[model samples]
Target: MRITRYIVITLAAATFLTGQGMHRETAERMKDRGLSTLDSYEMLKELTGTIGHRLSGSDGYEKAVLWSQRRLKEAGADSVWTEPVMVPRWVRGPVEKAFARSGGKNHELTVCALGGTVGTEKKGVTGRVIEVRSFDDVRALGESAKGAVLFFNRPFDRTRVNTGEAYGGAVNQRGSGAIEAAKVGAVGVIVRSMTNAMDDEPHTGAMRYDSAVPKIPAAAVSTMDAEMLSALLKKDPGTTVTIQLSAQSHPDVLSSNVIGEIRGSEFPEQIVLVGGHLDSWDKGTGAHDDGSGVAQSIEVIKLMKALGLRPKRTIRVVLFANEENGLKGALAYASRDANVRERHIAAIESDAGGFLPRGFGISADSIKFGKLTQYASLLDVVGAGKITAGGGGADIGPLKPFGTALIGLSPESQRYFDYHHSNHDTIDKVHPRELELGAIAMAILSWAIAQDGL
Candidate 1:
């Protein structure tokens, strides 16, 4: 009996080692193909240069949908299609002007209207500028805030090494500043742009107003201008700023989530999902924001096809719509009826900028995380071996309820916020080699999950 047990144990150990060796070999091949071809960068250049920014419900978005479908087909997806989603339509009209008058001098304040802000009249609104650090400060002024341009001048926290954390620490002022200011009868609000960089380029992002309060126009002042305005307010207590915005919110428009898949050889019903949002803010071409992610997601399909590495479970790539202003596409994809028949074992998202690959952030239980870390050896060659906790994208958040394991590709994030939601986020900012490394990392992890279910 002891001899038989030893024989069984030895066979099991050998089998495990053989599987690990094969996976390493496959990862090496993927790295070779990804580095030699640099297909992801070429695809990103075409998408960003040809289609430009794909804000939800715009002609550019529709063009991107068609382009994604064609690219997926070209990449050898067995099936490709679109799912309908209705998205909010907000346009930044031709006029968005702001200036501060202090000490009898007019200083132009670089600004852009936040998405979904109400437009000011043709004459514009001028009011005494009252700079406040937080909502508490706005309330403290009470009646003083009435008819004042409540400037939320909270600067992005620069101490945090993770720029995303720094953005999170300060972005609340931008998202809800208008509602809080309007509640106190403020006429308009000017938020400091959400970036650690002290540049003159204004960044625009989404903001909201409570229906109970009067709607007020909102804009983001450039970080440098925010500092200047703050200094002027200290020097001259009674500084007035004039702002005009022609931003308008129209009816919701129809859009679609682009999807393509390679069917599993064994468990076709089970899926390993990979995705990124297709929509972006209109300030720039969105090359880094999510264009890199979209290209990488599609390139997963290409890489698998090129190497002829078929998995035991399906690999689906979804380019989500309306992620900039809303997650309607994500919500639609995760709806009960849409997912009743499908079983998604895991979902990976690549929304971070096209920077150098560091590792992955995982949202999973300790058991699954431990299992995932076992594959770290395969990824260490590409410099993406680290796996941390609590990571997922806004588009993939909805899938959590379905017991699907969530993974986010974490790139080096120091420079991401400098160009985020601004005109600086352009194609030239991305490097070809860095972009391909990210794709290679994603492909290796995806293949591991598909081949050995977790």
Candidate 2:
């Protein structure tokens, strides 16, 4: 909680004198390096191209742990380690199919199984289809939904400027639609894709079941398919469909949180942590959702080493596991050892896509947060240098109770959902210059926090 780092840095910043002047000088050097550097871009390509999707408890995820551990050391982190964590494994079996038939016409819907959903028998579950706009509609139907396939066809609010906000408005149906439908004895549940884009690509995300409800099958229908089904339902009230989801859950698997740090020259125990989830959904390589974050976190240390600016506090970067389906990794890291959490001054996470850097979301008290605004403004050269209110990330949420200053790197949100959790979230979607800018933004802020106590 001491912030003499920013206070001292801001005073000598204009004059660029000594002490904190060295911090500014080194940050300027990092800025120049970021502009010309292809490291971030190249690193992301290697991960997405090679490792591909790394879902929690999958073989890909285990490989990602080893890959990240080696890469962290190769990036010149002073020390690297992994903490064991057990994560639930959800596997998508082969051939997921969902199709509707009405008035002798057939509509083959593009669909993928929602994470953590149970699989139907070999032939699949076919029954009368019930279309509902929201959970209220399902409740209204009440017992009428018994033994029927309930489709939650809520569309993202395209009117919202922030697509993330639009996704938030509609995603609850995807996350909780099954639980509600199950209460009404629904045998199957379908949710619309959580994206503003009206496309055939079905987005898959995490969904959980309330222990009291019987586990049932769930799938995400593409936005276009959702609209098609809705229209068809109106045309023929008794339209029916067969959903054959081959997904199943198995025993939990052992996973690891990839962690590394640059030991501080001064307060080595005080830590400023930066990270993103290493595990992604089992779709197209998760370049935007988190491959970008993993590479960017490691890139921060690389940039720091290149600049030769030793921090006053330990700079730790953790590539957490199981963020997509479960928070086991985040919780594990936060509770790993009491002593570690006690020394954690701040934790920053970059999980937003590798879009243009907008600004950072700072979460701290007025006094401590004010220091961040001043120290963080040094990133103004890159558009992502501003400081805003209300920030933290899912992977870092567990650290709040320990008095850790939680921060989230905000990026342009216009197109993030377009590729999120879908096949479009590939490495090709990431722009090199934009990715580097995000890495630079995090590096500058991390340096600021690492320069002293947070």
Candidate 3:
């Protein structure tokens, strides 16, 4: 499973096209065919408005699985089915908010409880708010944070080239802040929404607690609200904030990963995988978070079949479930028997917001990726020419240990944070042309990999 083997295989397979003098014509044909079939607007509408939020273990997740199966089958994919996976179901109950009095005026703030957070007693918990920028600062406060609500006001660094990287740097606070704060006796936690843009929308995401640490209720405050709270706390350290969140977690439930495949005529046993998570957060419609990815993956299969492009390797599209609350769908799919794992050659995931595709983040070696770069000219027409050497989306990360060449589709991240995990991630936020360009980029890559046998 060394990465170099994939490169050798791809180069060997592609030699046939070049030797036969069909490379140029094939490229041109694919370019023409892909542009004709790529339609982002219709796909986004179908996924966001029609399918809506697809949280795993919920009814919406099941419906999305069925929708994917029907669409793939209608697209002339050879096979379509579901793979069972166990997923977590955390329900956001009646979440309400109140704030401490400052000069007799109550400042009402916007907030959403974090996923996997424990609910307060029916009466709720209220405590003085303490703001900290980083985990180190929280540790510095120590006992000072006791009986207080720890507010993480760190903002995404917009100066980074890739917004995803900026999100990665700042996300540890959101994911582990509660657990860290609880160690010293903090009663509750409030994280600044992970976005570069200043807005009132509070983003929600999953948080984890250490086994030994006490689990406390955690929520996210909008970036602007976080600033307001921080400013208030500076002036009046004793300012108390009252939070009432009725959110609760249900027992784990059975769910599934929807899969569809266009079997390769030459090498049905070898596979190239393309996918996106089917699950989304409860807020908004989850349109940009992953609805765009699911549609684009399906569109790849549709375009391939319509163009009469029979790949050398089986191209599979899997819509994973529970990517928001847990990675159950990815884990279950990866845990398949050894024989099934052996056939998988590559897995590409597109969970980034559905914006104009800038390039692909590849996690393979130079040689394998160099061979992949052969399609650079083909993708340039669709504006996905920037291919870097490092990446894989969360849903496909598990496949890497099994020697699968993993990739993440990189889209324009400028506005991704604006809607991610917020109420703004609705169908309207996504541009039709940008979504279509992403679909075309994915289709081109999938087609090239399938034909090249990797």
Best by lDDT: 1
Determine which window of 10 residues in candidate 3 has minimal summed lDDT: 19-28
Q: Which tens-of-lDDT digit does each residue in 122-231 have in candidate 1?
A: 98899999999988999898987889999999887788999989888999898999999999988999999999999999999889989999999999999999999999
TM-score for candidate 1: 0.96
C-alpha displacement of 8 in model 2, angstroms? 13
- For residue 369, give model 3's deviation from the true position in Å: 2.4
Instruction: Tell me the tens digit of each residue's lDDT in model 2 across 67-179.
Output: 98888888899999999999999899897999999988889999999999999998999879998888789999988999999998878888898687788899998889899
Error of 2 at 142 (Å): 0.9
Of models 2 and 3, which has the larger TM-score? 2
Candidate 1 segments exceeding 4 Å error: 1-17
TM-score of each model, in listed order: 0.96, 0.94, 0.93
Q: How far is candidate 2 from the true structure (C-alpha RMSD, Å)?
A: 3.3
Instruction: Report how far off residue 247 is in candidate 3 (Å).
Output: 0.4
- Candidate 3 global CA lDDT score: 0.81
Model 2 regions lying over 4 Å from their true place: 1-22, 338-342
Q: Per-residue lDDT of 1-454 in model 3, one digit per residue for the tens?
A: 7789999879876785473244345445655665565554676688677778777667877888888788878877888889888888888888656465554567877889888888888767788888788989999988888898888888888789778889998999989999999998999988899988888888999999898988888988888888888888777777878778888888888888998999888888888899998899878889988988988888888777877778888899988988888899888888889436347778888899888898888887677787666666666767787888899898998887767778889998888888898889999898777777787778777777777664
Residue 147, candidate 3: C-alpha displacement in angstroms: 1.0
The lDDT of each candidate is 0.92, 0.88, 0.81
